[model samples]
Target chain A: MHDDLYLALRQCIIDGDPEQAIELCQRALAAGIAALDAINEGLVPGLNHVGEQFAQGEMFLPDLVMAGEAMKAATAILEPAMQKAGARRETLGKVVLGTVQGDIHEIGKTLVGTMLSASGFEVHDLGVDVPFETFAVKARELNADVVGVSALLTTTMTGQKNVVEALERHGLRPRVKIVVGGAPVTRSWGEEIGADGYGEDALAAVALAKTLLGK
Target chain B: MQPKLEILERELIERILGEAFTLIAEPGVKVQAPAAVELLAGAGARIEEGVAHIPEALARRALASAPREFFLHNRAGEAVVRYGGDAVQFDPGSSCVHILDPATLEHRMTQAADLVRLVQVAEMLPQYAAQSTAVVCNDVPKETGDLYRLFLVLLHSSKPIVTGAFAAHSVPVMIELLAADSGGREALRRKPRAVFDVCPSPPLHWSEFAGQNLADLARAGVPAEVVSVPLAGAAAPVTLAGTLVQHAAECISGIVIHQLAQPGAPVVWGGAPAIFDMRSGITAMGAVETAMLNVACAQVGKHLGLPTHGYLTGSDAKVMDAQAGMESGVAALMGALGGINMISGAGMLDSLACHSAEKLVLDAETIAMAQRVLQGIRPRGESLALAMFAQAGLRGEFLKLAETRKLFRSEQHLPSSVIDRGSLHAWEQSGAKDTFARARERVAELLAAYRRPALAAEVEGELKAIVGEQARRAGMEQLPGLGT
Candidate 1:
């Protein structure tokens, strides 16, 4: 019976049905299966499958985003149960993300956040037009392991450097890894801005975050 | 009279526009510029998380104010290139990074001298009505590259230019360069000697830089050409018609932002769309489907009574071979027949990554043929060919007749030595050169014949000072290819 429940949970994520995923989580709880097992044996494996398909070009951006949505919804349902049982999901790191100030481009930054969260990172997306101080404050409050700044315009990409300086001014530079990305951000630009790393795209961002945390 | 080609049916175009307007109001366009968002919100567009759901009524209002025609003027203030109503013109492709070396048969990074040579060659060719910043100069700093190109074009060529900016900040400076050449900002606006090409990101999005450019160009009364690029099956829908709907939506939203900033600004419904080759993962600019997409997209623009432009006459071949000729020739004919007002991409190859001056000369012959085709068949006299036949009287001497002499010059298109029409004996005497060899010779002859156009000393001094300041700001001591 537990095996069937785990299989159904995996199917919920692959099919990207958030409501169905929530229903299955409740069923797992009612059937007395551990919430941690449901996630480790079911949800993570399903997301891994989606990631593999995405890398192979079998899946696209919308599919990956939907799968991420299903995972987020399913996790919310089991969080209370997992805490009651003194269980925890393994996280790679905590990441604070946003499109830098004076720029409103959101698609790329949102994609990077979703991918990081789905890959087991604790993501706090600050949203678009975020001030540099907000990034510093968030990193200090959340004790984030990584901070990713995005800018889609050549004119506004200078904000990435401002972000790096803000982190240094707050003395959060040593603890937090800085990763800059966008359509205009390049590897050399990241180096020039004193960023720890650069993500050419969302997938690369996730991988770079993992490497930074030594996972 | 000119022959015309239409790919989309009247009903299909209406359906595409209808679907496009619905898309604009539903998913809306993701505008990254805050000022643009404010303008749309003030115009009654529903804003949701930076996406503006523009109403159909607003788009129509913008379209109504856009001018249906505009002119790009030469340095002498002659209206040489028209952008409306089946007036076909051609210019070399813009912003290539490599120039193909005829000796090495390999691509090398371009420098300021390469661009100067291209401008000089293009100036002598009557086939290219306007000039383009044909190649990027690798010697210059990246931040100042866009302005540096325009400065070089103004200094080297007398023709009006088609150029674009890499960033929003660069746009104003480039415009200032043009204004300095035209006496003042208002004079430049009145007889605009240049048109800036602004592109929007595909799948219903416009980056902040592009949005800002649209607004600035509109307020300044400079012409803006909206180059909407949608790669099929990758960034957009796989089907051609579906891509057209996306293209129309992007362009319609761009026009809305442009016209809202300033009413009655000149904008061209232009695009450089191509099919994504699934096998190679490249945008095949030379494919027939790409040409169809360009022609059909222009058809939609014409249906709305707007000026049209398309990127054609480019090839994906690596060299000046048969593939280059076939791809470039066919597309040039199709674009001309389809009535694209300003057809670009003449010397471009390798999917628009490289430019070759020899290929530019060769493509001029191809363009000459296409222009001849556009003339179609016309009756010159009352009896057609009967008068010439009567004068010859079955003696097989029509070539010697006065009527033949008088009419053949107008009737026949006399291509240059780039195209061979001599007998084998004559060809051997001329060294039996292939088309590329002949094109190389032609390029050399044209460059030799190029003469710089005269400019007032004060205007020249103003241009030098402006460009010199920019060069210093970019940390360069002196400009490349310009002697003190």
Candidate 2:
């Protein structure tokens, strides 16, 4: 019976229904199921499935975002219960994402943020026209595991390199990884700028974050 | 020769108009300009906060006052480009920040030299009736960029320019520069040397800057090409027809203000409408649906007997590849066949983010091909080559005859040396260059052959002085040095 409930919870996450996923979590707990089992067996597996499909090109950003929302809602409900039972919820990693300074392109960075969150990483989207200092400050504040910088113009692509230097200047580079992607950005550019990884698109970005975490 | 591609039925068009007016009356258009709000409110429009609920009749009346056709005259004071009556003219796309460097095949920020080279190429091409302030020169201050681009084009070519003013204050300054070229304000108004493209923000919003520019263009007697950009599935409805209604309403709102500011001024039924690619979330200007929207909207504009324009002959490809050729060629043909008056946005790549002079040369060929297609079959006096048939009678000796010599030039579009029509042996001997390489060579040849049109020394001095004054106003000591 609990297995069937866990399956329902997984479907709710896949369907991207945060409300339904939270209600399912409540029903599972009311049925005397362990909160850890609900998260590890249901929500985590569900998000992992979404991430795999995204990496395999079977799912897109919108679907991944919905599933991420569902997982977040389910986790919000389960974390308190897990704490009461002397356990804590696990995460893949934390990510800080934004379009670099002087570039206001929103779509690419937001897509990567959504995919990272869906892949079980806690993503903080700093939004467009973000200053270089802010990326470093946010990474330090959130204790972020990865910083993903995006730039759509060649004129502003240098800002991405400056972001890497900023993180290094703040002494956060040793602990946190850096990933860069945009229309004009390439893998060689990422390497030349001392970034840990580079992605051509959102799926590759999610995979890069996962690899950085050794997941 | 006029060719049209019609999509909406008569009843469907009527229904669309009804729906459009209903949309305007309910949610109305958001007019951010206080003067525009007052202007509409005084003209029987019901104003609720920022939105102006225009009556259907008021919009139709504005449409009536707009000229059915207007001409953009060259420096020679001749009507070279018609903005009505199934005329088709193309100009290179505008305001791209980067140029695809032909030497290195890399995209870089456009400089003063790049813009001058672009203007020279466009000036040499007979296919381009007018020139545009195509690439934004990064060397110039952003405040004075628009007028400086206009200055560069006017100095390099005698052609009429399709330019825009970024800030409302710059509109009059650009107009003054054009007046200096045209001799005076009266001469400029009588035969305007340039048309300013004034745009409105999409999804039923016109900001105060655009509003002021429209009114200024109207009162100054300079033509205002109202470019309404609607991004479907984001700012507009997902369906094409639904998007068309919103486009019509937005254009209608612009017309009302433009005509109210000065009745019987020249205003184009122009827009750059494209589908929002849901996956990429970028405005897909190269999408077939984007071309379809242009054709359909122009058709509606023609139905209303208004001058029409569309953004076409552009591609989303990052380079001048097969995708660029396919997208640019197909859209150019569609706009021509649909009888759009002025089709802008050629020679653009990476979704209009970059410009290429080589692509401009290639697109000139594409436009020439589309123009050939629109010419249709010219029946030769009902003879159907009977005179030639009587002499040859399938003997296949026509190539040796006088009629063949007389007819071949008229019948065939013998492309320039830019297009490779040679045999394999000849091709191999020419270093086996690709289309892009050939285009680069052609670009070099065109620039080498370009002769700057002579202008009056005083007028040239006046234009330079105006640029210098504008630059100083923007906190620059002088204008950027003009490059060769």
> Whose lDDT is greatest here?
1
Q: CA lDDT of A98 in candidate 1? A: 98
Reference-based lDDT, residue B199, model 1 = 88
CA shift of A125, model 2, Å: 6.6
Q: lDDT tens digits, residues A1-215, model 2? A: 68899888888878899999989999988999889999878877787787777667677556777887888798888878889999865678889999998676666787788777766677899998899999999999999999999997555777888999999999997789999998767787789889999997787887788888899
Query: Mind sharing the TM-score for model 2?
Result: 0.85
Instruction: For candidate 2, write residues B1-484 as lDDT tens digits.
Output: 3556777788777777788888888889988777688789989999887889999999989999999988888888888888898888899898887789887878887877788888899998988988999987777877788889999988899998899887778898999999999889998888887888887777788888788888889888899888887878766787999988988888888989999999998889998999876665567889999999998888878888999989999899988888998999999999999888889898899876789999999999999988887877786445878887888888879898787898787777777776888999999999998888888888999999998888889999999999888888878765553654
* Candidate that would win on TM-score: 2
| Candidate 1: regions farther than 4 A off | A1-215
- lDDT by candidate, in order shown: 0.89, 0.85
Go through the candidates in order and give each one's DockQ. 0.08, 0.19
For model 2, state the Cα shift of residue B220 in Å: 2.1
Off by over 4 Å in 2: A16-56, A61-113, A119-215
Residues B1-484 of candidate 1: C-alpha lDDT, one tens digit per residue: 7898899999999999999999999999999888788889999999999899999999999999999999999999999999999988899998887789988987877888888988888898888999998888878887788899999999988898999988888988998999999889999989999888898988898888899999999988889999998888777898999999999999999999999999999999999988866543456879999999999999999998899889998899989999999999989999999999888899998876789999999988899898999988899998987887878878878779877788887799999999999999999998999999999999999988878788788988898898888889999887886631
